[model samples]
Target chain A: MNKLKNTFYPLTAPKLFITDKLMRLLLMGAASTSVLVVCLIFLFLFKEAGPFAFKPGLGKLLDSQWIPVSFQQERFGVGSLLSGSALVTALAMLVTVPISVLVAIYIAEIARPGEREFLKPFIEILASIPSVVLGFFGLLVVAPLVKATFGLSTGLTALTGALLLSLMAIPTIISLSEDALVSVPYALKNASLALGASQLQTIFRVTLPAALPGIVAAVMLGIGRVIGETMAVLMVTGNAAILTASPLSSVRTMTATIAAEMGEVPFGSIHYQALFWIGIILLVITFALNIVAQRVLKKYGMMK
Target chain B: MNNTADKFILLSLRLITYAIVLVVGYILFDIIRNGFSALNWQFVSSFPRRSGAAGGIFPAIVGTFYLVVGTIAVSLPLGVGGAIYLAEYAEQNRFNSLIRLAIITLAGVPSIVFGLFGLGIFVLFFGFGPSILAGSLTLACMVLPTIIVASEESLRAVPKGFRDASLALGATKWEMIRTNVLPYSLSGMITGAILGIGRAAGETAPILLTVAAFYLPRLPKSVFDQVMALPYHLYILATQHPEAERIRHMQYGTALILLLLVLGLSLGAILLRTHSRKKFRW
Candidate 1:
């Protein structure tokens, strides 16, 4: 085909086909636009955030208060929000990682074919549920239960936010982890079984290890979703930017800070810059998580 | 003894899986029970009265519809075009990997950050203000990664043999992609776009900082107008309403509508994907 095309190609260099070259370049330009958008996000964030982001020398971010709208001496200490985000994310990951991994294993190794079919779609549907509804549910259901159980002043706490976020992250974890587990070679499991290993042991000792990298990728995805969740956490988290580690404490997250405060802040104000700085931080962290996940998948030969 | 232990472990896993299912069931049941009470046609069609103390979420519904339409317009063409480049044209090299990395990174960026980007670039920088245009562009960027990845996967699913055959029959690569690859992969692409729309409709974060209003309960006159969206409206009612506890049923109703809209689109996508897989099975 190459020879035939060359013979018919205006009797010159094949690359001299201006139309073909132009079309290829057009596609490449469109494709690279995604990269350009990514660059633009980072640049725009930094451009908007740079002045205030550096004014506090980065360590002021560790200050224990976050009163960006004060009558005097506005404090941009994200410590409270950072701690809140950490506390909620830690609790959320603690619940979701185990449950989601177990769910993936069940779907991959234990569930009957009929069960698998139903479970997959059900999970997808669960993922499709809006975060706001989950937030509402947390406010209505989980918050009250937590408050009643713990004898708290209000149900709004890191616990409520974490619980809802864990629910939200589960589907991402289960789906991706299940994909990895499903791709594990059947022959490897069979070999373990033939060696007198129990079905459970084969799954645990062989399949899980083989799928480890992909599972890591899945967990990273869950981490990305959980930390980035805004509405549910914003609603149930009490929005109190307090520097406390207790799950019972009402704390704000970096995301909730932006959403709750950005609406009222004057454009180009220092407060606006502070919020953009938080966004830049989020962009960096999530980008890092995503790149690491992609690298893991590529290394495991699962990424195309 | 080992068999018994394995049985216990497997049983526990299955129980947890069922627990997850039950959790989902409980949420749906709760939403429906409360939302059903306030879901009369009057509530659905009428504008809010008494400063959201009573009446319907009509403007929110309309605004969300407009945003979804605008988002699909912006994302679909670019996403499909980029996917075509990735699947058909790009060589296996550093540049391609970098593009993939960018897509993955874009996908993972928190929607709030996209909200910020939209605030910076679209609203402030481009002077679109807090309007529907800003919100749609923000959402389009956010969903573009999903569309690109899904479309690329579908494009890959189109058998290389088809492309080869087209080329052998004297078709250019562009011709082969348009007539052969695109037609076959379109179902998957549309499925992806459907899922993207669902996400876009359900999203509050991107719009919160870009175009969502605190309580503007009227439909917008143009793309430059700020509008009330369902997710943001629900958020306000759930958390910020001074009488949030009093308007509980109304909040649930809005949530239920948003939930149904999003879930319906996602269900449609899943069904189409299943159908496409069966039809295109090698």
Candidate 2:
């Protein structure tokens, strides 16, 4: 039987075995590339940002002004930028979370099958619109309307940025929250309904509570997206590093600061290092948010 | 009283949903309504004049095309191979879970951070130097997580019976995957790839630092040459141009083209996904 098999298959089992081993190695290498890339990103960002941390010291980051290009003295205080990012993200979340959760609930529970099909794709399309295009819309269309309504001079304020950012973030929250809502076992809803609850009551009392963890995860992810967004905010936020809480005032996010300054700052200069340091901060924030979000989903068995 | 409250709440939800839809519709209508006046055959086919304030956006379109192709080339194989390993080979353990965490983190990394990383690695370390090669690699890294997740889901969707049957018939593991597994999952993989392409094409931040030129209207002869991209082009026109106000028409035109390209890719992916669902039942 061995001789017959050898005659039929000229390529020996040893050769096939070697080929399989090589392929597995190649595939493993490919799989591990993502981990390697993540490591390299942290490494390089820290490498560039390290020098600035030492020479300037981390205290400079706490200063309230961000005049990096001043002729006599350059300040790298990120307080205002941090405040700006926080303000925009906070405002965006304030607007986005309620609307997106409601939309998710509507789609998951209230919409007819045909309406769900129509609305789902519409939201996905909204998600896929390029940020730059939305920024352009904000610049020409929304900015003007905002300026006229608020009687602001420039119209590029935190409010405008927050509104557009909320738009950008809405799709993410809705989709993920929709998934969370849909995953609630029918038994829970049926029980709520059998207990003399209406559809709205069942959704609000049973489904909403069950999906809360997932909804929180979705909102965190949305906040991460809003915080990390660069181009749109840069174009629409007026790029002012002002320490203010008013949404009508111009603000500069850490992301917009890096994007706006990185292009002009000489390589290896303090300004460049400052940008890299900002990159590190952004990376760490988003990383933490993502990890927490994933943990929430995993702990609740909301994600596969 | 309870009935009135429920009616109000449901009515508010329905109104808000419709409002969201209308906002999206208005944005689209605004762009298409204004963009048509600026778009002409000559505008799309001819090269820019006077720093993109006048003339066509041919080079930007071509550059974007080159980028999408390059991104596909670099990412598709790596993503698919990674998916195969994860779906078929990896043991469920701490290490694999760590890999999953890394992918999730990578996906959540901001695009600008990706740009900075690309600058450090490809543009400086590898000496690709602000070129399409650097940009494509950057985008590939950005989109890798998406492709991996999508492809893995598709791979997992194939029934285990097919694989068992092939292996039971005396085929090697690779032979079983090649003959019975991969063919069925290719369409789904392609659908994911298209979604990734849509994202890569639309992203401006990664390319801004790594590859995009401010006004290089000429087509790149080599991957090393910096090329103008659609998103960056619109950005400069809308924000940085000295004649930004004068060039409103051009800005709208560029925005329209980019909007169509990205939305069209997304639409195609959606269609392809539905078609694959209908065709492949098992």
Candidate number achieving the greatest DockQ relative to the actual structure: 2
lDDT of 2 at A213: 96
Q: What is the TM-score of each candidate against the true structure?
A: 0.95, 0.98
User: For residues B167-254, what per-residue lDDT tens digits would candidate 2 score against the true structure?
Assistant: 9998887878889999999999999999999999999899989999999878999999999999999999999999999999999999
Q: Which regions of candidate 2 fall more than 4 Å away from where they truly are?
A: A1-3, A8-10
Per-residue lDDT, model 2, residue B130, is 97
Evaluate fnat for each of the predicted models and list the values in order: 0.77, 0.73
Which docking band does candidate 1 fall into? Answer: medium
DockQ for model 1 equals 0.68
Tell me candidate 1's interface RMSD: 1.7
Task: Give lDDT tens digits, candidate 2, residues A6-36.
Answer: 8767767777778888888898889898899
Q: What's the i-RMS for candidate 2 in angstroms?
A: 0.8
lDDT against the true structure, per candidate, is 0.89, 0.93
